[model samples]
Target: MKVDKVASSPIPVSQLNQPAYPQTEQPQRPTSVRPQTTIEQAITATAADQLAQLPDIDAEKVTAVKNALARGELELDIHALSSAVMRFHTGHE
Candidate 1:
């Protein structure tokens, strides 16, 4: 939960006069960011478009379920469902 003051600062101020921080020596990582290749960027855009096209809710399935409920035809095998759910939660096949 630490913030990089140097990175987040509005402007890069010269710290030439300041004494070095007495922290443990670690290899410095490069801060420069490289641009993604055109193909990579295009693939990302295509993936995002595919995700956006997906329905928030499966409308046909929802309608079918609602109709079944209204007709009192919605049957649930409680024991089988419960066992399957329990097995799933316990990570047992």
Candidate 2:
């Protein structure tokens, strides 16, 4: 509780108001420089470009399949289809 008994601070009182080290100007990076693209990004862009060139749906193939189904030429393998679907959902071979 006595002021005379209190220990003095290790740092000088003058240094308390000022920074410990001098501030230096940092070099700025050039804004014109572009970041390099990763391999994954390049592959994805290539895939997207390839996909854009292809048709969304094969109309000719769809029409042929529809005609075949209507003619009863394409037999519906319900058991095999169900088994394949079950395997897909279960992640099994």
Name the candidate that leads on TM-score.
2
| Candidate 2 C-alpha RMSD relative to the actual structure | 6.3
TM-score of each: 0.38, 0.52
Model 1: per-residue Cα lDDT over 1-93, one tens digit each: 997656565544666546687577898877997876798899999999999999999999999999998898987778888889989999774
Please tell me which predicted candidate would have the highest lDDT against the true structure: 2
Write model 2 residue lDDT over 62-81, tens digit each, in one string. 99999998999998889898
- Among all windows of 10 consecutive residues in model 2, the one with the lowest summed lDDT is 1-10
Query: In lDDT terms, how accurate is model 1?
Result: 0.84
